[model samples]
Target: MTSSAANRRTSLSAFLLGALLLLLLGGAAAVWALNRFPQVAQLAGLQPPADALVPATQPRAVATVPIGPQPLTNAVPVDALPATEARVATLEARLARVENATSRAESSAGRADALLVAFAARRAIDRGVALGYLEPLLTERFGPTHPQAVATIVTSSRRPVRLDQLAADFAVLAPTLKAAPESDSLWQTMRRQMGDLVTIRRADQPSQRPIATYDRAVARLNSGQVDQALAEAMRLPGITAAPAWVGNARRYIAAHRALDQIESAALLAR
Candidate 1:
């Protein structure tokens, strides 16, 4: 009888060991699947959605008065912000991401939308140096007119800077399919070929007829085209200072390049 009981116990232990092995194998498979499709929240239990997850919610449209009895200008509306500590914590985290982005241009364009989402994120503006770059994008993407764009930028940002650009690559393919493509499908395809949008290529260089111009130039002084930009700036109607476009060219013209933050500052000044 003791031997019989021992045999029964042995059988139970073997069964448990087999079950444990199966569980381990299943877990390994799940890890493999999860690594490939990161958006899947469930491990082989659910069908994955077709689209990858993007944070939903277009930021609520907010207006900054460019002109009013009290036009909002670099003013903190912290008093109007909600008083939830959790929300404040979330904002602090987001601000950290903006502060840590790879480049100034990237940080500005990538972070503006998210920053504007925080109802009172504007107050945090006093803490960093992103405002100058952020404004132009917010204005171009959201506002209908330059004046409105300018006003929105000036009022929303704690740091106000200038806006300058020689060419803009209005994505020809990007215009809403709801509109006609003829009016849309052209980008001097960018002086774009040059790479930076803040740098201006005389949209039409002595055109016999005309040229459809679309482009955006950004900093170096491009180093590659600094000499060219300088020559052109010298010829402009009545401007003396180095244009961001020319500065960018000059930057790229050399082996090592840095407009010394001049690109961003120049862009903001524009």
Candidate 2:
């Protein structure tokens, strides 16, 4: 009985090994048949789509922004490639033109802002305030030329001054300087007082009296000659008492001179 059982077990192991070998061979044969005949794969539901079965005849279309090469599966027809490339080129050219236009507009806007700031700085100078506020703006927009002019003006016009108003004040103060000096003799003082009392000069004509010098100074100040007016004023006897007026006149002259320099620099900049 032991001999019979051992033989039976050996026969069963041989049969199982034979079955495994047959299954492997059959699977390999099926694969070969599917490769050789597509109809066999289709019948077995293992065939790819018809489009996938053919090799791509055209290159794939690339994006305008360039994301690198694409696969053949993402390829397009050869006839449609020229239209796609032309469209991308046209879009790129239009985008370039738009960028150029934007650059030009920004440049123009920057120039406009500079000009406006220059105008505002001029107004501030005229008003004689906030002068320091314009220095950096002028330096940034027009460089050292305008900023230097502004600095000179600020230095020269340390005191606020105006020629027209100063002339009016001088007109009101002229009568005070018309009297004779305290150092004069009694005879001269009497004669001067008598001459003033008997004075009958024409209102429309220039006088030959000491007061005529003050009148001339007023005219010079009215004509924008602050230096000449101040010179004439200094010649008067009691001029030292009006030091504030003379100082303001000096500032007026200096400020205008600095303004002339600014104008010259601006013209050159233009």
Candidate 3:
């Protein structure tokens, strides 16, 4: 029985030593874990100094609904495209007006240049030159109204008026015209022949007698009153010079009338 007790005591001591060794190895492992992981140390109630611990992150601020109007999702604003389009349209209208004005100004300048050329051509025609090189320019500017009018003017301008020569010829013709008349009485013919020689002298007074009337017609022709002269001469019957003078006077009147028409047209066009 004493031997059994001694073995039992030795067994108890061996068991105690084995338990102490295990407890010491567990404590050393826990210390190593605490050094490697601070979170583990904090969980175990071993907090580190404030400087040694990582800082905690703050909560992010969240955006709330806008106070007033919210912005649209479109990349361009809803009203912006229309406003830009209106501006473009306005600019385009302005550009069109400018272009139209420029075109009108250029047309006016071109017409004015053509008119100058036409006037020069008219002067040359008056000097008895042919229509020649300037005919196209005059036709473009003026002949559209009356094509024949241009031809009439050019043809008439080339003809000589010759009213002075016609007047001198009419002086030679007046005696034959006054000598006898089919429409006059014998007393009237005798009165006309005597009045041709007799001098009635009142400087301010005018005479309507046939001899005095023929004298007035000759005076009108000398002064270039061709239409008036021809009219006065036609009143006296049996004047041989009437037909030729009438033809020339009609031609002169037509040329001047055509010139006036072209000038008026040019002014109105401007």
TM-score of each: 0.19, 0.43, 0.50
* lDDT of each candidate versus the true structure: 0.42, 0.72, 0.72
* Per-candidate clash tally: 37, 0, 0
Residue lDDT tens for model 3, 169-242: 67777876544567679898777678667757698866646676788888887786767777777766556535
Instruction: Write candidate 2's Cα lDDT for 1-270 as tens digits.
Output: 999999999999999999999999999998899899988888778877777879898988977875887669967989999999999999999999999999888776766676665566556655656557666666565555555556666664345565557977787767666655667789988887677667787898655466767878878887878888888887765576677788777777766666666554554442
lDDT of 1 by residue, 1-270 (tens): 999999999999999999999999999988787877766645444655545355667889898767657766987588745666668989999998786764665756645543442222233232323455555554553344234433533453443221222222112211221122233235633333333334445766531111111111112123334444444334332222334444443323321121222223323431
Please give the TM-score that candidate 3 achieves against the real structure: 0.50
lDDT for residue 106 in candidate 3, whole number 0-100: 84
lDDT of 1 at 197: 30
Which pairs in model 2 have colliding backbones? Answer: none
In candidate 2, position 109 carries an lDDT of: 76
lDDT of 3: 0.72
